[model samples]
Target: MSITVEKFVEEGRDPFSLEVVAGHEYLGRIIKEAALNRPGLALAGFFQHFAHLRVQVLGLAENAYLKSLTPDERGQRLHRLYQKKIPCVVLTRNRQPSSEILECAEAFKVPILKTPMITNRFINLATLLMENLTAPLVRYQGTMLEIMGIGVLMEGQAGIGKSETALALIERGHSLVSDDLTVLRKDSTGAIVGYADDMTRYHMEIRGLGIIHVPSLFGVASMRREMHLDLVVRLERFDPKKEYDRTGLNSETISILGADVPLLTIPVAAGRDIAHVVEVAALNQKLKQLGHDAAKELDEKLVRALERKRRM
Candidate 1:
């Protein structure tokens, strides 16, 4: 998940209020770690336990310390900080870089970036940005929906009426996350979130309907930009030979970007209300999450009754 300094700058320029101060060409320096470091100790000539792999931050204290030093000592200390092979240096509070800081950065080929945000706020914001930039991501072929708070991923053959079913669910008050394609990413919480690409977000392509916007037609409540993937439903043409799970006792699951999610193989046939069935499935999944398993409870009750009959 390492990113180049250039990547961080490009992605964080507006948010971080970043402006290149020195070593413009050195923006390509690789960021081996996503954490930030304050070089106060290093600037004071204490190199022990220096976080050389992180992006160096020069806040007010460090800047003031440099201002107190003689020009010769300032240049020497700045040179030492850059020589530690740090990814880059960031000055918070939009503090102007001293001549010595600029000279040392260019001499050692270390990029210097400054942000107008305060030191503590900049650190927090940059931390989140780095984590998001490095999170594991994957692209899936499916229609994503949020039905009654449950995130469902409807996957199947391209023409198995996924968009049609999504439309029905939208009418039933469910929200659409994506149509035809979903981009999944494993966040820091170890949850899989499904989102749509910007190119066709909130747009569904029905066989004869061509392309239609969900939010525009059904109102904004009918569409969601992203939702955590709770269940996966695979739709297929009904085959009499195939044995479907009539009882919910045997649960199936699929892995999305390393997170295991419940999977259901739903048969699509004439006269079947797929939307109603999927909605029920989503509610059932929610019940299971809340520690209510109707199938298991019924089986347990039946077992207890059989045990009593045997004793009699």
Candidate 2:
């Protein structure tokens, strides 16, 4: 996106006093030029040389102060600003302008808008408008890796094979997002998503391997800037006593970015293909999302069989 300039009369508030000719010209230019703009788009051009330059427009009191300034002072102020050919002058408060100010507006073709809002509110509204109109690129952290069909968040006590699994997944035709920490942001609809930070996009740290670049080892599609986290697979050493959930009957979960993501426990046992298992688990989760819960269906069948036998 391209950033568009907006003229705010007193913070783009309602009930603005605009020079009819100037407003017509400005709005006409905007309608002809600005195309396919996002909603709430705005960019402001503030004219500093206004009536009573010393008058600070702060919050609600701005209007009262402008009202106190003498009419001659205000007229000269508007004239000077109009001569500068600035976009618009924001008259603070709902204070109506004097006749001299209005006449100068009609003659010089400069808009005079009266706003009841403070500077902060005006600035915020302006910022929102600009962003919506432009759709600028946003900075983010963490790498997004597609393991099988699952969006696995590979996080652990550093040194864990996060990048390694990502590399393996990439070799298996999966994609890599970020390598280390991923910064997550919620969209307007509240969907949490991930993206990679530029500094550590393709970089990863393996103890003996040191820092390695992922893109160098794998092709372009192998790396992604960011992805939505659908699963969290924390790799830890295998514990013999820990009875791992061999069955997916009881789906486990972990909270990330305020959403409960399905979780899986993969024990890193020697000779076992941990990465492969994680990949399969992700695939299984995708299936579940499609309304095919394999474990639940099997368990339901077993329960019915037991009930039939008991009745017989």
The lDDT leader among the candidates is 1
What total of clashing residue pairs does each candidate reach? Answer: 0, 12
TM-scores of all predicted structures: 0.94, 0.56
lDDT of 1 by residue, 134-204 (tens): 88989899999999999999999988889899999999999999999999988889999889998999799
TM-score, model 1 to reference: 0.94
lDDT of 2 at 33: 23
Top candidate by TM-score? 1
For model 2, residues 1-312, the per-residue Cα lDDT tens digits are: 332123332223342332222344443112112122111111112443332211122234433443566776656654554464444444444455667656766686545444564455654554454333333233323335776556777656554566667667778888877777676655444455676765877777666788888778777777776666677776777789888887777778865545677777677777877668778878887888799999889989999999999999
Candidate 2 wrong stretches, greater than 4 Å: 1-143
RMSD of 1: 1.7
- Give residue 160's lDDT in candidate 2 (0 to 100): 53
- Candidate 2 lDDT at 146 equals 75
What is the C-alpha local distance difference test score of each model? 0.92, 0.57
Error of 1 at 201 (Å): 1.6
